[model samples]
Each structure stands twice: as structure tokens, then as C-alpha cells.
Target: MNPRITDHPAVPYERTRRVAFTFEGRTLHGYEGEPVATALHAAGVRVLSRSFKYHRPRGIGLTCGAPSCPNCQLTIDGQYGVPGCATPLRGGESVRRERAWPSADHDLFGVIDRFSPFIRAGFQFRLFRRSPRLAHLAERVMGLIAGGGREVTPDAIARAARPGLGERRTALAVVGAGVAGLAGALAAADAGLEVVLVDQGAEPGGALRAETAPVRTPDGGAAPGFALAAELAARAAAHPAIEVLTGSTALGWYEGGVLPVHTPSGVLTLRPARLLVATGDYDQPLLFPGNDRPGVMVAGAVQRLVNIDHVRPGSRAVVVTRDAYGYAVAAQLCAVGVEIAALVDPRPGERAGADAEASFPSGVAASGVPHLTGHRLREALGRRTVTGVVVEPQEGVDGRGRAVRLDCDVVVVSAGRRPAEELLLQRLYHGDITLDPGPGTALPDGVAVAGGAAGITDPAEALTTGADAGARLARWSPENPALPEISPYPLSPGQAGRPSSSGGTSE
Candidate 1:
């Protein structure tokens, strides 16, 4: 469903050709050292590592190669570390599975699973208060041990990795290649604005790139959303004023429209007259029994694996959802031979799935896709990897329902998305860095929100939002300027795990 080879530039064509990479001394082939994460996954190395608190088992959570997770530490390149999810692999590269005191598979700390029963959600806090000395020490040690942090071999990869970005320039830079960022880029290009669209991937389309098959535009229109996205990318790429950074990931935003974007070559401190953030949402993992496992993945991750990567998450998948995105993705997967064991819609009262056939083809398109209303995951049965899921039926919720077991190798958690608002919390509206909910509630200045980040999601609004952000940035003037408005995605009344400080920093 990813818009037939996005008309936009893709990784600009690999120059070094393919090379061999070693995972645990086992040689595998890929586009010469692409990312260590990608190679391992293709080789069916599912359990990319293990867990943290309970040392339960873990795998490549996402493809970003965010380095190895301490929760599931390992030894890569002769060094003990976390697997860099996004790190590319080459002929000589070596990737080793975890080798802890006991082992990543069966860690001595894993006994925490047994104590998990007594340790409620925040058991550490209670223990700290009751037995401050040992509890506090244990918590600190545990926290440090579970830092889940990773260090990357920047020098090695940078020196060897080869990618190209022909000379191009833009007045404004848009971070995040999702729906909103793409929208901002398109609009800015249309208004004769010099725009630079950057994405972490090898393409331009943002989350729009993540989705499978074009669904209804915001309105019931026939815009050919995918085509539109590709066409716009093409148009912008061809436009003299617009430049696209396909593999460049924006690291962070700085004062005066300066963005430090990470490119394969080096850290690029992009200086622009204006900056459009447009960084969209990240899948929030749902809290449930046995939530941490190798086979359990975010809904967006499943969609990416199937559609973009052309990889199957599992032969059969059970999509647990409270959102339409999940349903649509599942439908697409089902269409392409991937079976949808069932579509678990948590809220039975919600009629989102009622018109499934309209949005996506029913029966074969979503065959065996029974929309289980009020269906909640009681537990997932898996010893090492996911084996199946357990469902508990809610009476009167589905009128027709009961406890059922669905056999599947994968569990897609489609809970919801939360804007990566760490930067937002780093700034303040009035006091420059005061705490309290951000009133701006949109992409902040020098940090324009677009795509899902701007809340311009899906078919229709994606285009408009991108264009709007671009236009605004292009038309920006000091003499008679416009003040920016940013809205946080999770701007609900109550949402958090900690407290905020006076400097707009969340603790």
C-alpha cells in the first residue's frame, strides 16, 4: 500500500552495491552494511535481545537501529552492548546475541518475573518508602542496570557507510517525513517557497509512507491519496526551490531556525530562516499481562514490516486496537495473504469498525476478520516468542461474544499515538521554560508541527497541512509576521508518569 515506489527520491540508489554482514559470526547478505538491524531481521533473527525489569525476552522493537537496548543487551563488533536497531550491516560486520552473566535468554535477574506478582505497577516506590536504605539502593542499581542505553560506533559507520545527497539548499527545513511534514513541504513548494523535506528513512513520505492502501481522504473524496503523495514528492523534488533529505534524520531543533539533522555523513546543523517540525506520533505500548515479548510489536511497526519492508510479521496476526489505523493496516495485511486472526476492537460501543467493508474490503479483504467488540487481551501465551493470545469477552458489549483463543505468532498493539513532545516539555510558552501544559498546543515556533505532528492525519488533511506549514513559513515576515500555534497530541486533562518543573522540563 505504500504508494507504488514513491515518486520521490529513494536512498538515491545504493552506490557501494551489496555486501556481507555477520550476525553472531553467521554471514548474511544485504545492501553492503545497510543497518545491522535490517539484516538480522531478514535472516529471521526475531529475538534481537531480552527484557529489562523481568529480563523477559525482547527483539528489535523498531527498525530504527536505535542501538542495542540495555533491557536486552548484547555483544556487537566484539564489544558488549545493545543492538543498534537502525545500524546497517556490511560484509565484515559482526552482530552477537546477548552474553550476560547467566545469559540474555535466562538472566539471573529474571527472577523478577516471579516477584512481579507482589510488585504492583509501582512496587519500587512502596519498597523504597518502607525499606528506604536497601530499597533505594536496589532501585538505583536496577535503574542503572536497566538504563537500556546504547553507544554506537559512529566513527566506523560514518567512515565506511556511503550515501549521497547532491548539492541542494532550502530556506526552511521540515523535520519528520510523516504526513504533516510532507504536507508542509508540498504547500511550501507550491507557494514558491524554498523547502527542504527531511525524513529518517530512505524516502520522503512520512507516516503516509507507513500506511497500506489509500483509505478515504478526510472527506469522502477520490484524491488518490497515495498518488497525490508520490506526485507531490515528485513535483517538489523536481522544483528548483525544494530539496528532499530522504535519509537525514533531524536530531533536534535549536534557536533561530537551526536544526541539527543526522545524516549518514555527519551531523548537519541545518540553518534555515524557518523550521517546520512536523514530527508525528510514536506508538504508545499498551500495558497488559506479558506485554513484553519478542513477537509483540506496535501496530505501526507491523504495518511498516509488511508494507514497506515487504516482510511478514507472522503467518497469522491478531490486531488489538481502539483505533481505525490498526484496522486498516490489518485489512491490508490480510489482503496480501497475511491472515488476520481477528480484529480486537476494545470499545464495543464505538462504531469505527461497523463500516469496515466501506473503508476496506470485507470478507476476503478482511476474511476471518471478525470485529470482536469489547474484546480485551487478558494475556498472551508465549514461552520465548509469541504463540497466541487470550481474550476475555465483555457481556452486553458485543451482544454476541465469549472467551476465545486465537492462534497467531504476532500481537500488534494498536493502542494509540503520543506526539514525541520531549522538545515541547523542554520549552515554555511565556516564561521561556516554565512548567504546566503547553498552551501553544501545536508545533512550536522554530518547531512547526505538520503531518500527524500537526494533527493533519490521513488522506486529505495530510496534503493540506504540509502545504499550509510550508506556505506559512514561506510567507513569514518580520514586518507583519504571524505568530505560531502548536498543539500537543496528548493534550488530555490527565496524562503522565512524572511531574513537571518550573522550567517547562518534565521529571
Candidate 2:
């Protein structure tokens, strides 16, 4: 029950239906639509998988529920390579950690961790060169031993995949249904242009889905941010022109401006006259020696666990950050009875020898939480999972800088975010296009960027950017009639229903 957040203040526990599953041969209970990782984490199962080379235990990295990460990859229902964190739990499913013999907890391949240094860098080419054939044999043997999960059965592949959704035509296609994407879809639809909103989540509202803080509304009023997310999502869902495709992703650009979208049902090749990309940023991992431990996760991951999944990350935690985001994570944790061990901040203007800062922002104002200035996380201490963290004072010390160790099971890192620029970069590399990384830059003729992917983090600003892009697309498209310009609601500080402006790089 310590890891289970049943009565959390920020998020309500409303599971769809009770279901049973087997994890590593043990029967476990979970909700039908919830992520398998959420149920496992709530049941006090931290180290879900292991790294390939070192076989080091891993829980969830950034915990974005993205299939791109390896933390959630496991063997599911006799099929190898499944995303435990993103996949919904179906009753009576069997899940096992892949790439480990015996089990992920007691893996036979774990001995490689001790001998990693000897065989890490080009060791295969260096040592296994008796003959080309012998070397090839050795490589094959090693690959079979330390490579990946069991072979994916052909029957599973045939049954799992269905036919594609075929080509879809629209006036505008907005990728990534975060705040910016959602706003852009609504704005374009309101402007009388057909919109296809595609997202990689089960529902709309990227981080807004997990946010618990109250935000400003266009009316300069405040309300719970999640409530605002719900309203905006509801409106988008009911919009006539807006085709909200949740649990889907815009894979990449194809020839003839066709964008391949992968959804749970099937694949969709969307051909929109104008494209607005609003893929948001992912939380960046902090720089520390033991940052990759099992219990170490980014602040956003903690928010997702607590707010979205209603799972307590850990009993005691340490937040390492340089901005206000860390404090917000602490507040969310505190709401669920998780004790914040320390807030290690290493920003400029914070004195190295000072005790605690004079004041903190209202969003991160935790009375009992220890706010330590000029302190940076040096290392996380533990063999398998995080047990404690070592913090050291920043530079400009009077030669009296000493490292301090704080005991904690989890380390929630808030080291800023990096834009999701894979699709953008892919376009730049292959397509003949020049993109300037700035507040507003001209893109290719038919493609435009908005929101976090365009380097805008403020919710209201992102909305405005989306609306601007939508209006521009509507005006440019010859098929759509010239409608009035769409505008988002105006907002003031602390107004509810709109997210506060935060981090994003230019362009």
C-alpha cells in the first residue's frame, strides 16, 4: 500500500475494471485500461527489466510510456518485444522480463556487469581474431547470449497486425496532440479547415493530462489544470472537423507529402495540404554518476506515476533541479504522503554556503521540504536501485565544500527538457529544406511548426502559436473558405485552464 496511491489528493483513482495478469509467473491484479508498468509499480515492483551490456536493473527511464525506451520492453503473451508501460493491461496476459535467463531479478547474464570493462570497447574485434570464421562464430555465440529477447513467433506477428487504415486526405494534419497540437486542431477546425489530430497517447493533452496544479484561463481566472485539460479535450473530441486520433503517431514523411501514421487499429497515410508539427519536448536526464539506477526517474515520470496512474513513486525522494519544475514535482509527491528528502538546486545567484533560500515560488512552496541552494547531485548510491544520493556544493566555495548524502529510495530529476526533434531533423536531412532555430522561422512550403516542437513552452503562447499556424494554413489552402482568424482565450498569471509558460529552445 505504500507504493499504491489510492487516496491521492491531486489525482483520483478511477480504474475502468478489475483484471488479473501474470508477471514473472506471479498473478497480479490491475485495471483493464491501465499500463502494465503502472500496476507493477503500484505493487512495489521497481526493477522491471535489465540493461543489455551490464545487465544493470532498470525500472522506467523518464517513464514517458513511450515505446522508444527500453525500460518497458518485455515478453508479453508469448510474444517478444512489447511495451509494458504503454500497452494496456488485458486480463490473463503473461509478461516476463526479456534478455535475462532465470529472471530479471536473478539473471545469469548479470556476470557480464562485472567483466564489462574488459569487453566493452571493440573487444570482440580485438580478442576473437583467430580466424574469420572462428571470429564470426564467436560473434554469433555472443549475440545469442547477450543480444535480446526470444524470437518473435510468426503466428503472433500474423495475428497481432491488421491491415492499414489506407490514405487519408485532410486540409491540415497536426502531429502530437499535446497542448499545442490540440489547440491547433481546434483553431483550424473553427477556421473551417478539415483537421486530423494525431497523438501517441491513449488520450489527448500530453503533460497537461498529468498536471495537478491550477492554471490561468483565457478569462484571467484560475482553475485546476487537469480540469482545464479535460474541458479542452472534450471540446476537441466533439468538434466536427477535428478527427482526434488518439493512440496513434505520425511516423515520418513519405514522398508526395504523405505522412504515415501508426495507430492501435492500423496505419494511416495522411495527406494534408498543410502540416503543423507540435511534438512536445521530453524531460532531460540529469548529469550524475548513478543517474541510470532503477529508482532514479525524471520529475515528469514521477508526475505521470502519481497524477495519471495514481501510483506513489517512492516513500522518500530527492529532487535534483535548477528550476521551479523540481519544486512542483515535490508538491505533487507531498500530496500523496511522499516525504521530500531534499531539494538540491545549483542555480546561479544562490550562495554556496547559504542555508536555505529566502523564499520560493508558490507553486513549489513546501514548508517542511529542505531547500538546499548551490548544491548539485554528485552520485546516486546503491547497487541495484537508488538508496541515497550524494550532493556537493557548487563552485566558488571557501575550500570547505563537503559532499552530503541523503537517504532516499527515489531521485526525481528536473533538469529541463529537450525538444522532440526527430521528425524535424529527419526532414532537414533528407528533404531540401532550411530551418532556423528561432522564435519564428520559415519552414518548407507546406510544413509549419508550433508549440514545444517550435520551441514554445508557455501554454497560452503555444495555443496562440497553434492558432496562428492554423489560421495561416486555412488562409493558404484554396479548398477551405477564408474564415475569420482563430484566437485562443487571453490569459493572466495564475489563471486556471491554461498552462504557465516554461522551458523551450528557440526553433
Candidate 3:
């Protein structure tokens, strides 16, 4: 049986309220609120979907829920495409794998992998086309092969699309309800500006929902971690001026701050005077052989599975990381009753020795769990799910060191994070702003960014930056006579832009 977490005394719902769902005509049971992808993983059902052409095996890579990777794309409720990791499993929900014939587990189209060399790019057309009639036939054949799911014709799209509701106007709109988005909303409301906060999750607080432990506060005191995410989420929900929309996703932005937000009920057109994109970050995966296995997961997803969903990822775990974030993950795994085989540090000996134990909590530190410094994960060994990790010393002689294999069912990787800047990038593309904004420039008016989305990882820094942005927007003036001018979100390492010159003063 898959290792399930049912030992947390603080959270009772972790073990109860099982909800059943159907996938590919097979009935499966999962928790009431957990993602369908997590439930599928717990049932050992990997390879959710196949690639368009080659049909290579795709398993959960990051489990990011953002669906940054195509590993977990599947059809839900007659929809031909959806991110299974991000899509929640409702009782009796029907899910099916897309782009795979017969089944995702045993796809007949997988034979295309053998002929991938002949089908590289448009080589097949050149190879098969002879005369005008033959070329037309070859084009038809290629189209049939390339199309994975049902044709998405204009008529089909119209049938599937939901009707748009009327528009709503707000003083300020925040795209995400994560750390930065929540902070921005609360600050803007506290500063007397009407605000609207939108998030994709069923609830607000973003990553804060997964953070259970206390973190160091700004003043060096202990705070309910995530800079009090629970407290902030509660306050935002109850704030008079702040309108919170859970399970709402900001689709896109247009000129004049016209935003199309996708809600479960329908589309909401938001004409906010100001917009803030604080969507936060997605976890980066480690690069190694067998990294795409079923049991391999990103550190953030593992935390969410344990703390938020109350699911144990595995019985034995190996954490491989380059930073202090990995230590925290190991501690969490240990607390959830998962055996931490070892903590592998890939940094050089000097840096690893100095900081390997810095982030470890007392429970993990005092347990005498083996800490392997300066060791790089050479490969993950297993046919399907992860079974063990082979590690070697980074500074060993002649690039060949004694390899140590740590047996573990799960491998949690915490390398770093990349900014979730898709929305920001899309908005920037519409304006005449160049991709490379010069260093230290102010930003365009009516737009602001904060938190992890702005590359600020420290929770304290994210909270402060978000509050600053909200406060500045509240006191915005044509001629800034009071507050020192705040810099824009960093375009590059040091590059920034001025606020939009045409932004009207706040009412």
C-alpha cells in the first residue's frame, strides 16, 4: 500500500472524509479536498498523460500545481485539457487521459517513439511528398498524427466556453492571494483603498496554508510562520474594503487595467484603477537521471502534501538540496513519521560544512540523522517509482568517488525557485516597454508587484515590499511631495522602471 499520513493529531481531517472519483473508468478514492493528481499518485497511478507526438512517459516532476510541466495534463469532466495537479478531485468526478489511445498506461501510439528520428520536425513531409496530390495526402497524414485530442475547432470552443458576466470596478486589484498578494490586499484595504484579491486555490493564503511551523519574525521574535499567513488570511476574508475571491484565476490584463478573471461560476471583467501581480514562485526541480520518476517530488509540493493535505509522500525519504530550504523539508518529513535516510548537500565542502546544519530544527538536528556534505545526487535508481538515490562526493579524486546509495521510496528535491512571471510578462508584452528596462528605473503607473513574484524570497521582505507597494499606491500623487519614490519590480538583476506617468491620483 502507498504510505499514507494519518498520524497528525492536530489535524483530524487528514485521515477521514474519503471522496471517491473515477479516472479512465476506474474508481479511486481520495481525500475530499486534495488535488486529483495527489490522489492518483497515492494510488500508484503514474504516467497520467502522453506527449503529443513521441508519446514518451510523463510522470509528476514538480507537482507544482501550476502545471508548468506537461506531465500531469488530463481531461476532466468532458474538458479535453486540464492540469490534474492543480485540479481538485470532487466526489464522483470523471477524469480521463488525453492524447493517448487505448490508455495512458498502455498507449498504442507509444510506438511512435521508435520513428521519432524520421519524424524530426518536418522531415516526414519532405520524405513522403512527391507530387502535388501526394503532398496534400502527406499533409493530411501528418495532421492526423500530430493532433492528439479532439479537434478544437471554433465551433467546439464556443460550445465549451462559458458566457461572460458584466464588469465590476474596483479601486485596486491583486492577481494572487499568496503571501505578497494577501499582504498587498490587506495593506491597501487598511490604507482606505477598495481592493479585490483573486486566487486560484479553493482558499486564500497561498503557500501559507502548507506552512505549519513558526518562522523568525522581522524583529527576531517567533511568528506563526509565513509571516502569520493564517492571521492575514482571516483578516483579509473579514476586511470590509477588501473583496476576496477564492477559486478565481486572473486570466489576462488589457489596456486601462481591464482584467479578465476566470471564476468557477463565470468570467469576471475587472476594471481596477491599479493592478498588482504577486503570483509568487514555482519550485525548480533537480537535474539528474530518473528525475521524472513517480515518487520524485519538489520540496514545496511535499510540504503541501504533508501539512495541507495530510498525506505522507513516502515511508523512507531522501532530501537532496543545494540550500538551507532542504533542511527544513527534511525536518518536516521526519515530523510526519517518514524516515529521512539522509540529507545530501551538493554545494562545495566549504559552504556545505558551514551551513549544512544551520536550518535544521532541533528535532532533526538532535536525531543524529546522517548529513552528507558536498555530495551530489548522481542518479535515482528504480524502474518506475523512486527506490534509492546514488550520491557521490563533489570533490573526490579524479571525478570518481565512492558512491553511496541511500535507499528511499521518495526523493524530495529543493534546488531553488523561479518567479511565476507569466502574467507579468504577458502584461509587459502589451505595452511599448522594452524587455530590458534599464537599471534603477521607476515602473509604469497603476501597476505594482510584491513578494516572491518580485524575486523577494524572504517572507519578511515579501511582507514589507507588499505593504510598501499598497501604501504608496494609496498615497499616489502626480508630484510626489511626501514619501520617497519607491523603485519598480526588478526587470533584470538591477534593472527597474518608473511607474506609469498617466496613472490618475487615488480617490
Candidate 4:
């Protein structure tokens, strides 16, 4: 089925600029600037690749904004191990599935999944141990098979050749162009400090780009998240003190505050007086049997697909969540004409008693959709793609209850989110830094953490923390008057939970 949504409430989908690309030698068309994975999904191509060991079918778990898994890897333009979700469709590019023989859809190696119980971890080391020659031969064969037949073409060789990286120096360097990063950059820039904002997305705004819900403004009014993002992005772009870099990734933090960034043109190294990391968080996948199936996707990924790319994940979906975010996803899906089979909440309580339900969009509740509380996902049932799901009450929490089965093509999971703290962890090991609970990490001089990475999940708090950090680094007062007061509710589901001192959820 074609899953492209032409009419969306928050996002406008106009396939005006169509571009053609070849996937496994078959020409496929999609809109320019959208992710290749999104294009394929719109074309009803669910299976993107195969798992490395079991050869089980895999698709996009998380979208391009935050790629936490290797499910959507492919060989693009002779380069191996390319992330399909992150790679944009620029037209005439060659994309091929990796780790599968013959084809990703009909792979001969798929039989290996049936025999996974026998092939345990380190099985290769145990086989043919007595014969050294046999062991060596087996190693060679295994390497060849695992390589996925990556071609060493001129494109790959040229890409591998790296001259000296370009260099830049700034007073403040902010990673992640999301709300937090934008606020930090603007705060520092207004304080007369030169700022550099870097983000891996095609545009600024971070998670706000995919957000369709109206955010609570400081003036007690409401505005769409995307609109706010646009306003911030435009201001940053026009600001003389701030240099905005989109489609750029921060490679790592090294000695002497050296931050190497990978841009579309080439690698650029930055040496800034102060660094602010507001990298945000990643969607966590729920654990269950058949959880890795093609049609099972994270809630944020579905949001990016529907709101950003205007591509419907599936015709019908079963949303499994523990918080109000799941209901928000169901509401968006319904808005785009996707039938909601059920909204399953694993929390143990009556639906009325759950505080999370307060955040559920009123439109979804009025739509006569089933809200199954006190139930947890038991299994996502299907062979390759999700066909249905089996859910049951929490054994001890919900008492004795009957199991329920819901049929749907997609299983939307809004389990939780983990902070993106790779850069912060890197500093802890390489520099003089002390880890603390919540957003209170004892960072070295000139280094700071903000937003979700700092355990500030609330959007208003994120902005406050970011502005405070920027102003503090500038030797100015941490209290920035330009930032808005923190609201009790941010008007975003799953974003209302308060961060505890132990870095856990107080909610």
C-alpha cells in the first residue's frame, strides 16, 4: 500500500520536485530533500536490510533526526555502511541493501534465523578448533560473508582520502540546533559573544521540526512547535554574531577543546572558548517478541515520517505507550487518516486515575478510539512486517485480566527516551569532569550541557538552562531576561515529566 499522505494538518505534503533513484537496480521516484528511507517507505518498501547475525528483516526503527539503531543501513553510491534514514534523496543515486544475499526481500540467508538457537555467540571460535588451517579458512569465509560484498569503487576511495580538515574559532560553540541550542546561541550572541551553532538535521529546530502540537508560550498563548522553530532559525540565520551550520555533525571532542565537525562539503575543526551540548534524546524501543520487525517503529520516528516527510507509516496502527506521548502519536496518526486500532497503556491503574491521560489530545478521545489501560504489550505478531499485536494486563500490577489481540500494520512504540550523552561521556574520560545526577554534571571549565542531554526534558527548562549556560560562559549574569518563564505544562505530551535529582523521572 502507498503510505504517502498528501493532506496533513500540521505538515503540507506537495510532491512537486520529484526525483528518481535506483534501489537494488530498480528505479524508484521520491521527492527531493526527503530522507531516502522515507521515500522507500512511501513506495511501500518496508524491509530495508537484514540483521547482521540472524539475517532477520529490518527497517527504519528511528528516522534521520536521531539514528540510534543500525536497522536502516545500506550501501549508497559504492560507499558501505551508509545510514539510509540520514541520507537525503538528491536524485540519481544508487542505493543497495547490505548483509543479504540475492535480495533483502527474498534472502537466502534468512534461513539462518530459524537456526539461530544453534549458532550462539562466539560459535565461530569453537568450530574446527583442532585444525588451524580449517579455522583460518572458516575465518576468511565468515569475513567475506559479513562484508556484504562492499565494492571498493573510485567514489569510496575518494571519500576515504582526507586532506587537512578546515578550521574555525568561535567564542561559543553549540551542538544541536534544537530549541536548547538555538536559545544558547542567541543568548551568547546577544551577550556580544561570537557563536557557532551546529546541527546534523537538514534544518534547524531539532525535534520541533517534527512536532505538530501547539506549545505553551510564556505569554499564556499557544503556537505550533514548527512555527517557533522557523522563527528561531530565521533569527539565527540573520544574526551577525551567530553562524548557523545545518546538515553538519559533530564528530568528537578532543584535546584542547578541539571539536571536529563533519559538514556536507568537508570536515571542519572548531576551537571555541566555551562549548554547549544540547544534543537532546533518542526514542527508546520497547522490548517484546518480534519487536525488531519492519513495521514496528519508534514514536518519534513515526512523527518525523508523518509530520516532516508527510509519509504515512502504515494504514492502521497499534500504539503501545506508558505515557501521554503515545496518545499524541495516535492523535497525529488519526489526523492523517490512519485508523487507530487501539491505544495501549502499560501503566497499572484505571484510565481516569492516570495523570498522563490528562495530556492526551481531546480530538483523539472524542474520536471513539479504544483506550486500553493497565495493559502491556506481550508480543508483536508477524513474519516480516507487523500484522497484529498481543497484549495482556501486567501480571502483578493489574491483577487477573484477559489478553487482547489487536490487528494493525504498524505498531507505534512510545516507551521512553534516553539522553544523547556521547559527547559528555567522552569529556568525562578524556578531561577533568565529574558526573552528577540529573543536569548537574560537574563539567570542566568552558564546557556545559543543556536540554535533554542535561536531563532537562521540559522545553521551557531546556531553554532556561541553555540561556543560563550561555550567559554564564560569557561572564554575564546567568539570569537572562530575554528567555520566557518556565510553564507548568509545556503543552507537549511526554515532555511534562519532571526530572528527579537521581536523574530519574519524578512523574
What is the Cα-based lDDT of residue 118 in candidate 4? 91
Q: Which should have the higher lDDT, number 1 or number 2?
A: 2
lDDT values for all models: 0.58, 0.72, 0.71, 0.75
Candidate 1 per-residue C-alpha lDDT over 259-284 given as tens digits, one digit per residue, 9 for 90 to 100: 66668676666777677766655566
Better by lDDT, candidate 3 or 2: 2
Q: Which 10 consecutive positions of candidate 1 have the poorest summed lDDT? A: 498-507
Q: State TM-scores per candidate.
A: 0.76, 0.89, 0.85, 0.89
On TM-score, the stronger of 2 and 3 is: 2
Using lDDT as the measure, the top candidate is 4
Clashing pairs in 4: none
Worst 10 residues of 3 by lDDT: 498-507
**Candidate 4 residue-wise lDDT, 1-507, digit = tens:** 458777687765567589999988799999999988888888888999988878889987633335356888888888888888888899998999888888889888889889999988878768877887887887777666665444688978797566656788888899998877888788889999999999988888887777766665445776676776777789899999999889888988988888998887778899987888878877777889999999899887888888888888999999887766666677788888999898887676564224334544354457677777777899999887889999988766763568989999999998767677777677677755665554435555566667777656555566666777777667632344333322121112133233222112100
Candidates in descending lDDT order: 4, 2, 3, 1
Question: Cα lDDT for residue 152, model 3?
Answer: 58
Cα-based lDDT at residue 362, candidate 2: 44
